[model samples]
Structures are given as C-alpha cells and as structure tokens.
Target: MKSSRKGLEICCGITATFLIVVALVFTTLWFTTFKPKEPEITAYPVGLEDINVFSIFFVRNITLNMTITINNHRNVGSFEFKNATAYVNYRGGVVAEVPIGQNLVPARGKLNTTTSADLMVGKIITNPVFFDDVAAGSLNLTATAALHGKVRLFEFVKIRATALSTCDISFSIASRNVQSTCKSKIKL
Candidate 1:
C-alpha cells in the first residue's frame, strides 16, 4: 500500500508539471502568433448626385458620388483614418483631386462612406478623347486614392500605413449611373 501511494504521488506531480508546461507554451504561441492584419478598403463611383449643364455655354457642373467601403478584419484592431482623397486620372494624367474626408473603422467590422467630387464638365471637354469616352456611353476613368490612418492592435500596438490604390471606374454619361471595377496594386 505504501509503495502504491508513492508511485501515485510521483505520477500526479509529473502530470501537473506537463500540463503547466503545455499551458505556458500555448500562451506564448498565442501572443506571439497574433499580429495586426492590413485592413481592406475599396472605393467605387456610385452615381451622379447633381449634374447641371448649360446648353448655350457648354458649361457643366457635376457632383459625382462614390462609395468607400472598409473592412477591418478581426485581429487587425481598429483604424482611425485621418484623411482620404481620390484623384481622377485620365490617360495617366490627373484631372481632378477630391478629398473624401476621414472616418473610423472598427475591428472585425465594416464601414461605408460616401465621397463626393465636384467636377467641371466643361473643363473635361478640353480633352477630345475624354469627351469621346463620355459620349461613348461609358466614361472609364481611374481613381487613385490615398488613405492615411493608424492601426491599433489590441489597443496597444499602433502603426500607421499610407495605403494607396488605383481603381477602375465607369460612369454612364447619358444617365446618372456608375460602376466600379476591381482595384489594382496597393502601395504602401
């Protein structure tokens, strides 16, 4: 009986030690493997909020509305966007630069923002090819956006990334319609 009791005591101690070591290893791995993931952001033209054209003068003022969607996946923490802007590019040239403003995106959540751009349609007419593209029923343009923000990881690790993306956009000049295509390479 005495021998059996001692052997049992030894087994219990070894088991406890093994369990504690396993727990320690797991805890270390948990924190070490955890990191902040880059947030997902996308922007696309939605429609024309306002369009006014004077037939006699051929001057036009247009308000283009775009939808900016952000997805902060879990483990990425929170994002506090300072400023966002989109530059309308035509054939590798910048025609218009619009500030989209700032907002916040929660962790593991999604945010939708509406950005507007005031455009001088008459000025765009200066480019014959641009006018042709618009008259063709689909005005194809590239939207290059810069997002300046800070990412908070577990409310502790804070890092800022100036992310920029080039996205293809299409608008129906005949109607107040817009379509968004996929984004190109994102630069940091």
Candidate 2:
C-alpha cells in the first residue's frame, strides 16, 4: 500500500517521542526530589496574661508588668527569637529567672509582649498571699526560645494570659494561716 502507509507513520512518531521523554523525566524528578519541609520549632509559648506588681511595698527595686498572648504554630516555616528564658514563680519557689529581651513570634500571628522585672519586695512573703493551691495562683510564666534554624516546625505553639487575667489582691493580713494567693480576677 505506499510502503505500508509509510511504515505506519514512522511508528506513530517514535511512540509519541518516547512518551514525551518519559514525561519530562518524571516531571524533573518530581521537582528536584520534591522538597517542602522546614520547621523544627524550639520552644516558648505559654501565655495567660495579667501580671502587675508595680507596687505592693516591693521596695529596693520594683517594676513588673506582664501582659501576654502569643502564638506561632509553625507548620512549614516562620521562626525566630534567638534568646529568651523568663520564669517568675511564687509559693513553688523560683522568684525570678528573667532574660527575655523580646523579639520573635510571627509565623501564624497573635502577638503581644510587655515584660519587665525588677522586684525586691523583700523577696515577697511578708505581705504575701497566693494560696490557690500554689498552682492556680497563676503567674507561672515560663519562656524558652531559640528556633532560628531547623525543620521540624510547630505542632502547637502556645502563649497565654490575656490581660490582668487574675490576681487582684487586697489583703491586710491578720495572721493565723492567712493566705491570699489570689489568682482569679479578670475584669480587664
């Protein structure tokens, strides 16, 4: 028939050019070995706001105002803050452990930072009062950061405390196991 129809049109154009070069080498090896994984969060995400100690006779050096609320649950990117380590406790010990100059929390939004510590109210205990099981007395702020380079991302970044969330003390003590570890007053 003309040479078998030109050998069946050159074998269908060499099998459609070898299936388009094997589909472009499997789409360039799946876009260069398929990459898209970089997120290994470090730490720092424990918030619950409201922490005011501007005055309570805390002499020698007093100034502590903490208003927290931060969240950055990294999924595949976003991370910073090469330094931070703040821990101010009470009743359970650890009065202070500050070192959060601030900076770093923008991968998923929800930011708010205002930390300052310099208390010396005689190491608080005289006019002390935070006896809500020593724990619910709140204000256990703990921060630790250093997520600048890695690839594990966040699973659930956190940061709580939403403005004077508690502790509105007003005690004039009278002794006799007098406890006032206030931590349940959120009017603002």
Candidate 3:
C-alpha cells in the first residue's frame, strides 16, 4: 500500500509540471502576438525666404513696424506659428526684440507673418536736415512656431501632438541710415 501511494504522488507531481510548461508556452505566444508598437517621430527644419521690413511708421509715440516672413517645407504633420519674437541691431549693438504676429499656419503647408514693435526716434532737424554721421545697421530675427497634430502613420494610423519650432537669422539692413530724419533729437 505504501509503494502504491508513492507512485500516485510521483504521477501527480509529473502532471503538475506538464501543466506549468503548457501554461508558460501559451503566455509567451499571447504576448508575442498581441503587444502594442512604439510611436514613430519625425521632425523637419524650418527655412526663411523673402524676409522684409514691410512697413515703418510712428504709431502712438512708438516707431512700430511689421517684419519677417518664413517658408516652411515640412513633409509631415501640421506646422503653425502662433507668435514670433525677433531682435534688431545697429552695427552689432542690440536695438530691439519685438513680438511679431499671432498667426496660424495650415497643416503641411506654408505661411507668412509679421512682427511689430514700438520704438523711440528723436530727430535733430526736420527742414532740409543735412546729417553727416550715419553708420550701418543689422537685424537678427528669431521666430517660434507652434506645431500640432500628426501626419498619416504607415498609410493608416495618425499620431497627434503639439510641439514648437524656432528659427534664428541675421542679415544686413540695407539703406537704413539714409532714411528721412525729422527735427527731433533721439533721446537714446
């Protein structure tokens, strides 16, 4: 009777071991066939084209103007520029950094915007003013555009999110010193 009991115990142990092995194999197969994939990310650089100082005038005690235009050539997702900030310098001297415009850029397309600021310009002479010392000037513009949404993933899926893109550039200001000078002296 004792030997019979021992044989039954061994059989039970072997059956339990076989069941555990089968369970492990099934779990492995399930995980390998049903796990989610990681997200795919792609980013492109921004470029500038036809950047110009659109207009310059004194608007309510400030020398205000609209400046900057950009061309985005991104092949994926949506690109939007909500606002932009840039700076201008006169002969390497920091002059101003003004906020441009609160504009929107369509998804996967191009856009143009403006940056406006108020400045203090005091002229020394108004009537036939003959000034001699007029130096050179430079402008360094930087812009930030907020990007949202995502492009078609693998020709089927769509991944969406919000991100930001920034651009910095420097260029020479042409004919900046020879502009019309009034009789007021600049107090800067």
On TM-score, the leading prediction is 1
By lDDT, the best candidate is 1
Q: By TM-score, how accurate is candidate 1?
A: 0.67
Give lDDT tens digits, candidate 3, residues 13-112.
Answer: 9999999999998788545632222221221212222223332233222334543333333333333333445443333333445664555434445555
lDDT digits (tens) for residues 1-58 of candidate 2: 9999999999999999999999998788545542222222222222212223333444
Our tally of clashes for model 1 stands at: 0
RMSD per model, one decimal: 6.4, 14.3, 15.2
Q: Kindly indicate the candidate among 2 and 3 with the higher TM-score.
A: 3
- CA displacement after TM-score superposition, residue 70 of candidate 1 (Å): 1.2
Off by over 4 Å in 2: 4-8, 15-17, 43-188
Candidate 1 structure quality by residue, lDDT tens digits, 46-142:
5452453224146565666777787666544676777766888766666667787788788789898887876656556666686567557666777
Find the 10 residues in a row with the least total lDDT in model 3.
179-188
Q: In candidate 2, where is summed lDDT lowest over 10 consecutive residues?
A: 179-188
Cα displacement (angstroms), candidate 3, residue 162, comes to 11
